[model samples]
Target chain A: MALINLAHGFVEVFQPFNMLMLFIGLVVGMAVSIMPGLGLVMGVVLALPFTYRMAIEPSVILLTAIYFSGTYAGCFSAILYRIPGEPMDVPMLWDGYTMARRGAPAKALGWALVAALIGGLVSSAVMVGLAGPMGDVALKFDSPDYFAAVFFGLTTVVALAGKSMVNSLISLCVGLLVATVGIDSIYGTERFAFGVPILRDGVQLVEVLVGMYGLGEILTRIGQGLHIEQPKETAQKVSTQFPTLRELIDIKVTLFRSTVLGTVLGVVPGAGATITAFIAYGIEKQYGRRRHLLGTGVPEGIVAPQIGATASVAGHMIPLLTLGLPGSGATAVILAAFLLHGVQPGPMLFESPASMLMVYTILASMFASVIGMCLLGFFWIRVVIKVLTIPQGILSAIVVMFCLVGSYANRNSMSDVWMIVIFGVLGYVFEKFKFPISPMVLGAILGPIGETAFMQSMISSNNDWTVFFKGPISGTLMAGSLLALSYPVLQQFLASRRRCAAVA
Target chain B: MTPGAATMPLRRLQAAAPYVVVLAVGIFLYIQADNFEFEQASGRIGPGAWPKIILVMMMATALWGVVSSALRAGHTAPEAVSEAEQDEALTQLPEIYPALVWIAVALTIAYLLLLPILGFFIATIVYTCVLMYLGHYRRPLRVALLSLAIALCFMFMFMRVVYVSLPPGVAPFDQLSYALMAAMGVH
Candidate 1:
């Protein structure tokens, strides 16, 4: 049954319309990725409203293509200019920039592209194999389990907070508060509608996304006087030079290690590409055969994090497809896209043959996107380099225009425009204070689902407070959330103790 | 690197802002959540129950933040305090001509306000041309031509292809949209 569904998806995804959309997404994504200041999450958010008029299949394929290529293209700038186009691309800069400085720019870029291809292929295979069985298991979950799952997903904010857990939690709480501004989901009661008739309709998620990530970003840059020191491109003549047979044999173990590590970490909700990239780099630096020569411009150093970050795309999709839990910020936006299209991507999503086929089609498109990205990056690296030359002030104006049109087009309501402005100002303020915005976005996306699941669990248990801990699955998930929430604090305490002991 | 100079009142105020804002928002939400009516009555979780619970968590978190910030301030040694202040200063955005931020905001507001009145086409063209000029792209012919071309392309894409019913403006400008749409066989 699964085979038949997947085969049907293969045919659907290969259709000319879906193929064209995929190609467009790759080109646009590559363009967006090569530009600094615009991160992968921003790229996804900017493309979201454009998909409003598209069918679900094309929309999913388009987004997947963007997601895939965006990861692939960031390494280009990191190698040629030492400017990481995306945060995940930062790890690539250590060895990639050094390799370029050592007059092997083509070799470093080639290694990154090759690693991305291997990682993406491996991750996709894992996703295709495991997602079906996982979805089947999720089908058996009750309301309490669902609630627990969302709660676990929410705790990702804490895991992602490197230094400021309190600020992240505050950002998350603000998102939850915003999510409650409209009519209450289950009770048909208004909670935060302060007598304004428009407020009763609730805040639109697209407006918030556009306002914060899009317009809000532009406003913040304008405030900074658009004073960014542009990185000078050193590679005058770009070429794609895949590693020779001897060189390929040299980094085989490093490649294999990062691919496996990235694939696994990608499945962990909240441990997105940036973390996976760093972890892969750390592992290579600590344990690889060429560990001493790790940061000194070697293939092993460049390949580790690039492959790990790219391969994790497949890992993120597994949980999103199975339990409808977004594992990363990119997946969070994709989840919002699925819900907007009236498709709830959980266990029930697989019960319908058509929906399952659609899901498979999207997964298949990711594979096609990897090949497309390899070809584009190999032949068009020079053209892609030109995207870096665009001035920030001009880009800001264009972005503002897109945000206005995108927000207005979402529902064609004037009120939505005002909402974007409000959220834009709020987003600008939060950013100035150095607050992480990802938690807030995740909180908004998962807020309604968490509330509904919690309410249903309460109703089913007849107001029994112990329902959450009574079930083994829910109990385990709740425990996981608590551990995740406290993990940072525990790490801090241990580090402090270690320091005291060392001093003594 | 004097301690007195480094630990200026502005730096302390900046450091405390996050905790202060979180506490204020939490208290406000708690007050608002208190007034939410319960149709299902007490004992049963109503519409307000989840929000109330979240608000309580937020308030507690805010309190923790405030206490933590205070403790952190009290524990800092004078020798290392300037070092900490320097790090914070490095992370904070430099105070450039800060009024440019407000000017950009005003420009955006003006563009939106003029959008429905002058239509997306005219409003966007004017907005972009002015923005480019201000941003140091001062070639008149280039700015005007580029803005017009970009604005039309945006209009055609959103209005004609995507079918967004953007305001056509009043009188002559409104007619331009219809004429363009009809010319393109979209109407």
Candidate 2:
């Protein structure tokens, strides 16, 4: 936390080899991000095994850098090809593609680069400043309070995400069911395997994500059909540069708001960047006409979500430091990394000098990554534009091949490929029906958290239900939810009635 | 976002089917769960109880969504374009999907066919080449070059340098991997 420690963090990564790795991480992660159906997870997964022999500090630094850079890299394609490189970058397709169509490819790419850099830099700084404090804050929470936090986190799927609260809840339930399919954590009894051994271990989150997001996407694509007219400007030249000050200022409120929102959201269990980005976008839009900036060719609009996206990742570490619970998606992956290293991350991690030093590297790596990305961003943006300019036939072919590789490379198994196909159909079906996928995904992620917390709360309370409501934290959270749920309905009804009165 | 793109009633029904199936499965689960440990008096609801609570919540939401979706159809024709729909090309289908699926299937089959015989490198190269083509790389020369690049990069980084247990393909590539390593000073 002191100046010297910050200096030490800088010295650690300033090594020649480490710096080179940063650049490689930036370039390759960006490349994967630009490829459809291959996003941050694939980028990180493929890069992970190679880093296993690496020292723990550098290995995490490399992976964490990739995690930050990969998200923005997706925006490159979303801008140029209207093909979102990843789900988190989906909103980019709205404005970036619009700008590309308007013959402002240079301006759009420039905006995207600037937005990404600012988003990354700001969020990383937030990480450096607030992680320790949040970790310090997390020290107060116990089992029931943690349970309440998880409960609120689950409800956030409805409160924060895409429309259709009911559908989100439905999806959440399905996820919990899936989460329960494996061995019971405490009793070691099998729940839902139906006698299949694979069910004994339950579905691996990696395989599930690959199938649900990757394979499911492919199936949905096939169901949509084959022949398609390509974008006319696929061959257009684009430039990447910094956005003007006015552009940065435009989303200042949004950036500030989302930074805080994401940090808070990240602390709670079960929330991830995808949720944070959407929630930030949704909330930012609600305040004014500025909402139109999103999904259109507006520079600041594109920056807002990216700001929130990166912050969510940083925000997740708070609870990991304070409560020993992983905050969100990538942090969950990091927790696994810690376990692999035989390092337990909990209250004492902050107390340990070596662990704290590593935390400094983890926080510092993002800044180093941002600089690395900025350097590579200029060059890779150009190269990727050329790649995107390839004729539709060729581009489609390459995407298809990578998509397959993405699925197959996971475990090098055929079942996963088939799983991807099945899920692709499911995704297409869901998309066709206007069913939101985030809730279902979030549900699956949160189900275990909810169930475990529920069990712990129940067991501790001896079935009194009082255990859950026993503490002020739980009571206050539950009370807050009641207000949150009803506020919107009342507000909407009043507005509608006011409109009628005006007309009368 | 388009007016005509309003979700078909049948589609809505289909969309809700997964939840209905999940609900039934949950019911079955709960029935089986009756025997699981739930010391309600002791404030220890069993795992089954926790799952049931979630499943019920899920059912309620799905029911609400299905009902609201139906009412939406009855009350309005869904002809209005909410602002979210503006500028969105609802009809334009992305070309990234079909080829991706076929390639996925092909890669799987290829992996299955060659994992025993061709080993990792051969299978990997072929997979990479096929993926490059599927990714829409038109020229065979370019596809070959890019695939070669990706394969070599991966082999060097993962297999040769890191000493990963790569699937040693048929004798030729196996020898070639060693020869390439020796030729390049890779140990």
Candidate 3:
């Protein structure tokens, strides 16, 4: 652990360019999250490919740093604009919007920043502490073990289901199916190309990722037709004070509890930060001392949700390191990034880990980016807040360009550029109707892993279906899935009955 | 927007119908393509079966999504407004078409022009300028300057260090790239 922490310090904060990237990530993350439509997932996804060219540590660090600051930046608009900048910022809306209306937008922002920064840094520390030991555990697994991890991750497709597991399942199915769209890898057979030479290479993960998240978001933003309201206050109407050390102490306990919760959830293969926030909200309502202060921009609520969300990033990496199962969208991107650079993740990754420094570089870059966020924060808010007023068309075009160049630049193929437009339309449609495009991207990312693992397990067992459940690890994971699938049903039932009783 | 409001399923249906149809068509194409396999598993496992399985999966999921939307619209609680009022009750946000449309057009144009002769670095600079304009950047000089600065920074960082081969340009700029490469310690 000492060596691990020491490695983080060894992360050469010395390079000005790498340091600049951290600052850039911090600034954009702050700005984009403040603007409507561009969520952290979008910011992270769009930014992922750019890192392919960077040294891995800096790349990962830059992306992780954005992941850190972007989530917090959403609160800025949530407080001032009565809009939740992104989905995770929704809880902040309740108290934040209230504070803004009450002429305390700045105060809400101040508290949120303090809470988010603390929450994020603490969770990152835990990640840095735990990643090495846990990653080492992954080194023991063989093909079957890899299969188990794939099995574990496949369950994550349904993680977004609010009340309908069936819809989520359908979405997951669609995503997996979409993965079959090109030349068959193993047998060299053309499956679904339909004579379009464009798709012979199969469904490109990067293209689909951008189409689904990036373009899908732009379309949704247009449909929503958002408008920014000018504030009446001439003096910026900002927060009164940053969270003082005394105030920080007051929220520290809540932060700790939330951090633990987030870390655990994040560590799980499928449960993302959204889940963490929802659960943290529930826990706060259940056990927080000032329960009445749940949504009133209370420091505890702000700190708790953030801790859970930040912890989710590092926790998500555990499965990625150990099982090669990406825990969430960013991890999915990380998986894609590794593959792009010709680094295969999973058991082989842990065995010798010839490219481990790339990942370490990402981690180093993440720490650097966080410090950069702090520095940028001093100036970013003053500038980025004005960006909110920029016309959406121009921004969308820039996004579209990135979407194209990003896809094209990956292989220097105009074919991929065209794929961007195709995916963009599909993405727009998916967004318009909320069909869960991420699942498809996730499916594409995990397709080979899932297939190879399933194939290996089958081949070893002579195509025996029963072999999928042979080991303790596999059994444990399957059992966990059954429990996860059932838990939500039971909760819904209980909640429904309580409502019935109240009505009666 | 008010929570728990139910609306006409037509909008949802209209939104989803196109995807269902496209996927359905894709399924048909996939079935036809399944027969075009390479001669006897050159590697491991015949190619046809896996792709076939994926196609069936995608079609099925899309169908499920269609059904789920229908179900959600059906089960929507009736406490707020009944089926009729829900249609008109939807709160639509304001549309800022100027920013969105121009930006999209500008991006598409830049991309089309950039792919051939101008090459990556020059193309990127031009594209970045157009983007800044689309972004409502008012000061012409600042926009141009910022665009150049951005282009230079990225060209050095991404194109040079990462060694992402910038598409070779025609004429003068092509020579410029060669010269710069020579100066930058490249063979």
DockQ for each model: 0.47, 0.32, 0.25
Residue A495 CA error for candidate 1 (Å)?
3.7
TM-score of each: 0.94, 0.77, 0.81
Index of the highest-lDDT prediction: 1
Evaluate model 1 with DockQ and give the value.
Answer: 0.47
Q: Per-residue lDDT tens digits of candidate 3, residues A395-459?
A: 66467556666776688778877777667766765544455565666777777777667667766
On the 0 to 100 scale, the lDDT of residue B44 in model 1 is: 66
Q: State each model's CA lDDT, in order.
A: 0.80, 0.61, 0.64
lDDT of 1 at A301: 81
Weakest 10 consecutive residues of candidate 3 chain B by summed lDDT: B83-92
Winning model by TM-score: 1
Clashing pairs in 1: none
Model 3 residue A73 CA deviation in Å: 1.9
Q: For candidate 1, lDDT tens digit of each residue in A1-504? A: 556666777788789999998888888788877776666777787788788888988987888888888888988887878667777777677788799899998889889989999999988888788878989889989989989988887786656744678878888878777888888877788878898877899888887777888777766766766554466653458887898878888888998899999899888777888778888998999999989997789888889998988888899988888888887677877887887888888888788777788888987887888888888899888887777877765776677778888888888988888888888888887777767777777787778888888889888788886899889989999999999998888978998898789879
- Summarize candidate 1's per-residue lDDT along B1-187 as a digit string, tens digits: 8786577555656567678777787777778877777576556677877888778777787778777776676555654354323422322346465576677778878988998888877888899987776555677897888898878888788877888888878888888867766775666
Q: What's the TM-score, to 2 decimals, of chain B in model 3?
A: 0.64
DockQ: which candidate is best?
Answer: 1
How would you class the docking of model 1? Answer: acceptable
